[model samples]
Target: MATIQFRLRSKANKNVSIKVRLSIDRNNVFELNTGFSINPKDWSETNNLPKQTTPENKLLSSDLKKLDSYIIENLNTDLGKSILIDSNWLESKINDCFSRVVKTDTSLLINHIQHIIDNANTRKVKNKIGLSASTIKNYTLFRNIISEYQKKIKKQIQFIEITKPFVDKFTNWLINTKNYSTNYAGKQLEILKTVCIDAEKNEIQVAPYSKIIQHFRESEKDRYIQTLSFEELELILNVDLSNIEQLNQFKKENPELTKNLSITPESLNNVRNWILLGCEIGQRGGDLLEITRENIRYNGKNYYIDLIQQKTNKSVTIGIIAPHVIDIVENNLPKKIPHQKLNEYAKVICKLAGIVEVVKGTKLNTETNRKELGNYPKYELIASHCFRRSFASNYYKKIPTPILINITGHSKESLFLTYINKREDKDANADLFMQFYEKLNKDKEPQLKIIKSGTND
Candidate 1:
């Protein structure tokens, strides 16, 4: 029979470290650190246990008893005697008892991430049965990044090693070495924290230091968002793409540029209409490109674009408020174009529409393959996402936020506000506040009156 006992290292009035003694007969004996401490006043010399007068003493005694039973049960098993018995082995058993470390392969950080990726489709979010395709893609990318980081450190990340300093090092590496934006690094760290939180929910033990791990604050430069204004949208909507003969003539003259682009007049025309539709509907590019004539529905008095959003699986009915948009939806809904084509052609179309205002934003450098911040023509930054943001920004105060949330599929107002760069629109918001202030005080009389400095008026 194997026996386990806990005792203080040295008797003292102050806190003293506790040690574990394990005996397998008289021939084999082992001592291990218990990672616990207590004062001599709380000890019971006769029983070799803490006195049960205080709650702390009771818990310590209870944990020591559990450790004793746990060790004896394991040592009595055939599996335990097959391996070598040493101080290190006894220390491992003590760690297991206290949950100071995870001993299972399933609890490894990389292995757990693989498990999460494999089961992503079956996992539920809100009311949906699976994560969005984009979300899964991002998770796969983050997994690759974590693998590279592990290689850099020459260590496999353990769930118990995800502490504040570990996350800080990872984030700094992402920003400094990987050339990732602060917000991008923060988002990746958030995903890592999410995995840890999910692991904890499944009864996995992580390091106590992980509780202090937090996301990096978004940098001001990264927080700057660029969206198409109403003027830009109108310019795109009314662009002169009807002159196919002139477009063909220009393409004929610029064969070197047009050869690879395959920019037909019809393609440009289709992209133009798609951009307008996206601005009006405020849906994601994936869902926006799928809109066809069939999505239009008549509600007796008004026409609506009814469809289920692909990412959220939530149905939204966009009421056709603008007469021009309603005209296009009812009669001239453009043929579906490739989402990539929309992204590429959108820049060309906007550039042709004379949207060349210099703006501060991030754009991909082809050589580096990373988005770098610089001043660029607004048209260069225009993409499918710009349309949704444009719709949100253009109609922010004109329409209620909740109604916009329904259309844009955003879960909350704060996220939507942040998405549209509300913090950067202080001047416009100030004008709106001034308008409301005047309206509230329209009929009120002035309270202040001029008086001499020496006189009590």
Candidate 2:
């Protein structure tokens, strides 16, 4: 049982603030300023409230009654037991009852992500304007993940509630329950932290621990690095798709294989040529797929594939030095295929070329909707990006590192090394160094012999 009443503290001629008092029991009591003001002349000292003689007084009295009813009704709920009866808490309750400064649906953590998504185009990062399509896609995914988390936990997550414990719980749910890889889970956590940090800039109150939340990920060494060997590339190039009759007969013999490759005899040659071109010039799938005949330029001695890389927006020129690659580029550059179709075609091509050696890798499991780690046939893991990786791995140390980095469009030598997963093996350079050292010594040998003979004489 509880009692709530409004009263003025001082009897003054001027307008005075109305205050609320609530008594839950004999010992428990709370009081707060209601922020409503009225002159004492308008109030009734006898009734301990505003008199309903005038229209203004009548409306004020009605509002007070409604406020009283709201307090009593909320006090009867389960949430009432957990609440500490104090002036500050009472003030919050009063504000909530009056719909003042309460958390709205748009202010929730989930909505914050949406707001970011909505304004993504206006936002800028580094030299580029707005978020990348991939970044927006990732953020959209993070928003959905957070929305699902809220539904599962049955609580609307608040910015103030994003503490260390909340981060730990969310991280656990992301990795263990959601089957997200450590690196992927780390990326989500990074997005969570970024959103929180962004919220702070907008004058939103976030828990201090949000800044310190660890984004966990596995090291590069523990990660499965996939690449195609040069021999595998050579094998794929040599797979003859010359005769339509032969291709049709092979397809009839292996219906499932042709269906999986989505192969047409005409398209097989085109996809194969693209695979070779992609490997010869190390570029991302998006940039590689978009390459046109107009991009191929010859500067007297060498033909170059010149373009501005989409990801970095930096210009790069990759020379087609290999005679076969040059010949193909000059005579026939493959017709463009869809990125997804190219990936599928590449795997089928690799498999047909006998690149089925079982190796440790990760592949997306459609059933689980995650990339699960296991030993799979090499061709099973092949994707469009494998060409870029294969190029880096195959040409490493054979070409000058700086030249390779420039062609690959890698900003740093260290990052390029991680991509190829190789160290500087200077065995060839060491042999060249030895030859130079031997030549210098040989040039001095005759002079040294002459000096020694003259001294002896």
Candidate 3:
């Protein structure tokens, strides 16, 4: 068993800092230096003296010695370093550590991550992978890719001692053999790098994954994932809410509401409200879902949604009541639910509203044939992130791009511009038709005035 020892370091100013050192031996060690903090109100330096001064300290006496003996017996290994610590030994050590310092079960990545993930089945992992899903998924893929490559190449190398060259070969295999996107292969390589970091912390110096600079194809300029036309956008906006069929359906399905439009409609008013909530607020899924009734209120006469963004950790006080968005908000008090449930609800609602493709990137316009577009009319590629993308897309087209970027908390224009969809030529033609109509009706009656926009008056 490795011991975690603590020590005091007194600086030149006579200020003391605590240092924690972890060591499997006197030779190999890692340390954490904690700086000083302000003293708490109730703690007294003199009053805490007796335990330090006398034999009254029971911690250094019996309990620590007993613990030391128990740990020594457990670690009575006349063993040499073998291939990555065997499962039984690793699990026992981790379990022992968990029992001793129970607060942080994941202090050591190798102990907690590898032992658990290596032994568990997919079902067990699916149930228990906490904030660790993204990490494990990549390593598991790397492991598979390596295994497959080894069989074909008849590599004279063991995977545990896999070198940088091997990693390069594996990455190439993932791209060429697996038919994976280079971007995805790059992501897996990055994840492999992290796993190597974890391995380093455990003193298992995995040869650097590779030395190759990551190469990615330039993303196409007009290869926008979103292609909503001006008419489609208008159809979404000018939907007749008082439709008798919707009312009848609402009466039948009292607790839930559904839409009838072929395109994405603002069905389930509350969920649509949340979708619009994401649109105007321009936050990641978690941040947008954190909005509550209190965070929204009239500041004199203007409405605002004020909440901390989840990913950026920055305060966002934007209006969800923007003219482009407000109609979806249901006028009522708010309710609280767990973040997970709310996120799940957002997913369900996004799909039900015909916005699923845009949310998941499961499908894209460029990927589909135009001839097949009608059958898959609602086949737009959407993702949970598409809310932020759509918000940026529309705002970039209608407003200043820089202002849109700032409002959405994007730090770079080029990175953000990728989210902006291209203008469809079909929509440009529609606007041209509108101009022609206006020209033809130059000397017309009030019937020519079907307003698609609001008047300042």
Candidate 4:
């Protein structure tokens, strides 16, 4: 039996040893031992080329199988730092195999997905953050779509080459068959395109694989419709952190008290202050951690906070702090705790406040509305983002122009527009009209006084 094994003898060779062994004699006498041929013609099928099929003029099955051999040969080439078979390189090769048949056998794409999961189980590259995991999950979903298509048609598809008609059908399937929204269906289409891109690269005459489905997708835009009310916001602002932090602190100071009950005031205050500061600045929690005494500065009359906003490399400066903000800064901020522990403690604060998130859509609205909505969402369940959203919103109510920009460190109107809401515009307009009416009456009162005195005579 011939077995495949990685040969990594050098650090600079990309040649993955696809060692083929054939022993004619029992005394380890290797009659044939060879590697994959580098030339494409060595594998190309003469029988399959002339009889072109369908609109694409696609190669027959025998031709594509021949092309796979060429791709495998290229992958095994000693082009890099080592003679080792890189796992990623093998994954790439497997992807090349699917690319050949993507226009021919959509089932081959599912095979590729299975290979990815197999690679994961084998610990080829186990990092969860890598491209493989996300692709695998997306492909898994795509596989289900293809399977459903097979069931609907009542016949297995031999070719993966999707035509314009197929794209129209895919759009309908994504909407009605899969019960996916336009946005969600587009995401699936994107995943399909990515897989197709991988396959197209392996073709001798590589055509655009994504062209089959691009027309079916809708443009994805931020359609966030979620927001918290002012009453709910205030309730979030005033969560009962008293007993919770006391217990947390007592765990440290009096471990004995922890056995019975131990949470501290200082810990509670820390939780409140952090939440408040986040709501005040609209800064990400990562940026918030970096905020130290050094960022605070003074230029004669004004106090300023300056830092490079980590998310964007843009430098941001803010001036004008309220007494409440100042008091929290001065008194509430604790000695830096380890980041790991700080996050854990933050969760504790949220839990103590009874915050729980209600997901967007039907299930959450109808089922979890009572538990997750109102004040409950803010204190415990809401993520770090709510603070930023709240801060952007609250600041808009009180400040204008350079002041809001300075405080939030936002420079672009477009960036701020995302944070702005219908309520903000309504309040601004309402206040302007009230002020204008007051001035009109004041201007007329003096003239009316003289007329009243004359009429009185």
Candidate 3 residue spans exceeding 4 A from truth: 1-164, 172-181, 197-204, 208-218, 221-224, 227-231, 241-267, 324-380, 397-402, 421-457
What are the per-model numbers of colliding residue pairs? Answer: 0, 0, 10, 25
lDDT of candidate 3 vs native?
A: 0.49
lDDT of 4 at 127: 36
What's the lDDT of the predicted structure labeled candidate 2?
0.83
Tens-place lDDT per residue, model 3, 150-240, is: 5788753322444666676777787777666656677766655555555555555344532232545426541435433334344434444
Candidate 1 off by > 4 Å: 1-102, 217-222, 248-259, 424-457
Ten residues in sequence with the least summed lDDT for candidate 3: 35-44
TM-score of each: 0.71, 0.71, 0.45, 0.43
Q: Against the unseen true structure, what C-alpha lDDT does each candidate score?
A: 0.82, 0.83, 0.49, 0.51
Better of 2 and 3 by TM-score: 2
Q: Which of candidates 2 and 4 is the stronger one according to TM-score?
A: 2
lDDT of 1: 0.82
How does residue 149 of candidate 1 score in lDDT? 95
| Residues 28-89 of candidate 4: C-alpha lDDT, one tens digit per residue | 32221122221222222353232244433243334334544644466446444455444444
Model 4, position 153: C-alpha lDDT score: 73
